[model samples]
Target: MRPSIKILEEDMKEKVVLEAMEILEEIGFFVENTEAVEILRNAGINVDSETQRALIPADLVKKSLKTAPQSISLYNRDGDFVTVLGGDNICFDPGSAALNVLDQETNEIRTAVTKDFVDFTKVVDQLEHIQAQSTAITCSDVPEKISDRYRLLIALIFSKKPIVTGTFVKESFEVMKDMLVAVRGSEEELRRKPLAIFDACPSPPLKWSDLTCQSIIDCAKYGIPSEFVSMPMTGATAPVTILGSIVQHAAETLAGLVITQIVSPGAPVIWGGSPAAFDMRKGTMYLASVDTILMDLGYVEIGKYLNLPTHAYLGMSDAKILDTQAGFETGMGSLLAGIKGVNMISGAGMMNFESTQSIQKVVIDNEIAGMTYKFVKGITQRDEPIAKNLLKEFDKKTHLLSHDHTMKWFREELYLPSTVVDRSTNEEWITKGRKSIGERANETVTKLLSKYPGVSLDNDIIEDLTRIMKYENVDFKTKLDL
Candidate 1:
């Protein structure tokens, strides 16, 4: 049997859902978009005109849950199937929208440029365990207005993986959607096989902004998947207790679900979030704290209870730099998320309370992800008589090392990591240059980028993508070398 972890029992899950629905029905959620408000009103839900708060009943919540898809299929830019966002199938991608990058040479956090993002995409493209690419870092060279779409453009040019991206404003979605259409050759095909999932976040204490509401509606209309990222800071923006914060998260996510399902009956949606446990003494939000990880796992159980695809911001650190603290937090959270079978695990390379991205950390986290995947597979009986038959052949003259059984199962059972992880003896380490983990990861990054086979896009498609961007008043030719 596959190993797993659970925080809420069957009855506890039911209680969480029931309380969430009650909160939505009584307290209501603030909906800023007029279009969204009208959609809810048309669906027979009560809405206040001045306040824009919609009172969604339990029946509406149940209906929306029924209409929303249980699974979402993501496709690469080349129209190949990548993975499904449901069940116990988990996939990992580097975190998104970091303002700064950890410089390899100086080991200092600085604003990321186009070259930095390019190198990051190339390295992630080569990593074996990181399943998808994200609009990981914003380029300081580009204008703030075009930052969202520009990052997506860079990711598409360098990697073929499906993207996990989001819009910064309402207008950026159409331009980004145009880029996806250009890659897929047509809007119909783009809708048929979605190449990306957009993240739409809800403000804590049960609120939805106009931009995010519009994003959910637009993605639903185009048949693209939308992930609800409800961030609830315990004892700060949300209630002090973990379960209380989860209830708030559920209410906010359920509100978004109602909007999406109302816009399109069978629209695809993911129950995802980036909630953190608040540190009152430091007045900081801890992404890797034990309380925060427990909250993530608990909410995922609620998502599974409702039979929806789930996601969370785990496998990240609160440390400012890459150190023992970074490794300890990242490994613990990542392993638990893997065991719990979160469908889309983000925040692989993020640090400093999710404000920074580290290339070295990403390389090391790739190894951690590999081990987590192996651990979840668990151990199985390899032979009919268990180990008795193999023990019979394990004599003094012929050791198990030379036996056929050892040769057959050793490679399959063991998860041999890359050079990013140290597995050498004392003498071997001294002879081969005792490099730090960061040093080895830096070398791996350089090697991967040096050997990366660049993506080849058709000239026509490239021109189309460029034209779409140029129409938005940003000239890529002047700023970047295409």
Candidate 2:
């Protein structure tokens, strides 16, 4: 889409960049970590000798960002389904941590499980706009020892799209490395068309975790696009103000960029966050508050200053129950963030502090993502006569099935809904027992997985991937593993 489709206009962008430079110069980020400080200084940022407060030259930030190649690709055994190389294309992905009550049999709302993850992945893989899958699905059943990559392994089986995931520990890094190798067929293939991974750092004063830093370094070396998602909870985690949260997010992200870029100058990175504020009344953190949305918008604006792609954690709710609040929170957040051109907006399909994930919400949120894509494209005027002449050619007696125009328009204009909004007539619904969204979603997941084998993967590559998944402790050791 070039800079034209950029969320920030030229004059607007320049002004923002200039102001950010000053903010960095005057206030400076509280980056005490020597690695981060030195990297910023080496990159020609002006750092205060004692405090390590720094201001990066706008030119350097732009240049470094420009080096991040506009596009990145991830492949399945079949081939690349998502290549975020910059286009009019915008799609929604999975939310992290499904901690709500998914299995009604249990009746208690809690964390998601390994099987729950597999089920959720199937529903997402079935989605159209969710071009990449985030193994944000949680595996609550697995021992903590294997929980991190456990969901990722389930995702690997179900998704052909690139899976966005995190490494909570050093060993999970190997699991991810091997997972990509399985998808790419070999280390050489992985290096050639790297998988995109989003990594996060705890916000300022706090440093990148030992596991996360190690993972970033490991990911950079392999050419995978590992982005930094710095989450700062204002009021609770930061200063309880949106502006304060933005700076903290900026500091954390830039520090990550320093390390990642140093590890590999163009180690494909995105500026992203999960920052939000706590609700004082309820004593809970609201993931979809106006403060959260606005702060995220501000962060993306800052990323535009650096000329990098962006990401944010929106579309999540603080609502404890899965109801209208969950839907509206997800929809509104998705709309603005998508309109603002967030490269990726994580946190969908969940309720309660992002600790729980749900298939029902995943399906519904994906539909929202599809709707958001429509908004981002806005409405374009086509020069063609599907404009007028085709409409005139429409005949009342003829069925649309026989009309070429129907096919043309349907392919271009249709935004199909997932299992969210009920589409059946009352009579039809009655006959079908008025199924809940969850019931339909559960059915949809089974249908997709049943259809998976018919959608083929290369046999030799599949064999190699099987070995890697097994070797990396990601399951799929058996010949029957899907």
Candidate 3:
């Protein structure tokens, strides 16, 4: 049997879904976009224009769910099938839209600039364990209006991997689509093999903003995959209990689903979220709290029960720096999510409760993901009687090292650590100057950036992108010499 983890029982999952439907029917969310409200109204749902509240019937929610695909496939820039986004297929990417990065030179958090996006994308593109690239860090140096599309443009230039990105405002969504079209050379080709998936979030406490609503409509119209990231801080923006927060998340996500499916019947949508608990004493949010992990696992079970692709904000640390605390939280959360078969887990490079991104953290998390992937492979039964062959080998050699069985099994059974994880003798460590994981990570970052292997875009396509950038008057200061 394949490795897996289950938190909610069958009946328990049903209860959560029923409660979510009830919440939708009674405490429906307010629709910020007039078009979205009209869509729901046309679908036989009740909409009160005065309150901006659209009461979604349980049947409508069920119908919308029926239209959502259970799986999605993402393609790379070369038009090659890369990763599937559903079932037990787990994928990991760096965090999205962080304001700052942990500088390797100063060892301090600083506002991330345009070069930071280029450098970060270069590092992520090289990490084997990181399945997709995200807008890892926002470019503070770029114009505020173009920052979202600028980050996507830079990621496309520097990485061949499929991307996970988002735009906060509505107008920029079109600009981002234009950029993708410019790179792909046509709108139909861009839709056929979309290189990026956009994250559309819902304001908590049963609310939807105009910008996010419009983004959902636009993404669906263009056939782009949309990930519904519903963030509910328990005890603050949502119910204090974990289960309560989950129910609210379900309702919020279904509300977005209704809007998307109504706009475009067969557009792709992911059952995704990033729910957390509010730390009352610290007056802060904890995405790495133990409760948060449980919430992620629980909600993933709900998504599986509903037969939808899953995504979660996991493997993140509340701690400001990489330390023992960061290690334990990230390792446990990542391991659980992997075993639970989350389709895509974001927040690999995040720190300080999603406020910062670190390339070193990305490196360390890559190793963590490697270990988790190994564990989720589980053990195999190569032979009918497992101990019989071992007994025969022991009788002959007193050790299995020289046996054919050992040679065949050892390679697949063990997970060797990368250079970032030191498993050396004390003397060897001293010989190598006893560098810490962080120091070793810095070395890895330098080596990867030095030999960054970005895909070669056609000169005409590059010129088209440049023309778009120049026409928009956006600055392009990213260093791509490597």
Instruction: Give me the candidate number with maximum TM-score.
Output: 1
Q: Tell me the tens digit of each residue's lDDT in model 1 across 1-482.
A: 78989899999899999999999999999999989988898999999998888999999999999999989888988999999999988999999999999998999999899888888998998888898999999988877888899888888888989999999989999999999999998889988898999999998889999999999999999988999999999999999999999999999999999999999999999999999999989988999999999999999999989999999998899988889999999999999999999999999889988888999999999999999999999887888988877777657445778677879999888999999899999898889899989999999998998999876777787778778876456677555566
TM-score computed on alpha carbons, candidate 1:
0.98
**Per-prediction RMSD in angstroms?**
1.3, 4.6, 1.7
Q: Model 2: residues >4 Å from true position, as ranges?
A: 1-63, 85-88, 97-101, 104-107, 382-411, 418-420, 425-431, 454-482
**What TM-score against the true fold does each predicted structure earn?**
0.98, 0.80, 0.96
Quality of model 3 by C-alpha lDDT? 0.86
Order of candidate numbers by TM-score, starting with the best:
1, 3, 2
Give lDDT: candidate 3, residue 452.
Answer: 77
Each model's lDDT comes to 0.91, 0.66, 0.86
Between candidates 1 and 3, name the one with more favorable TM-score.
Answer: 1
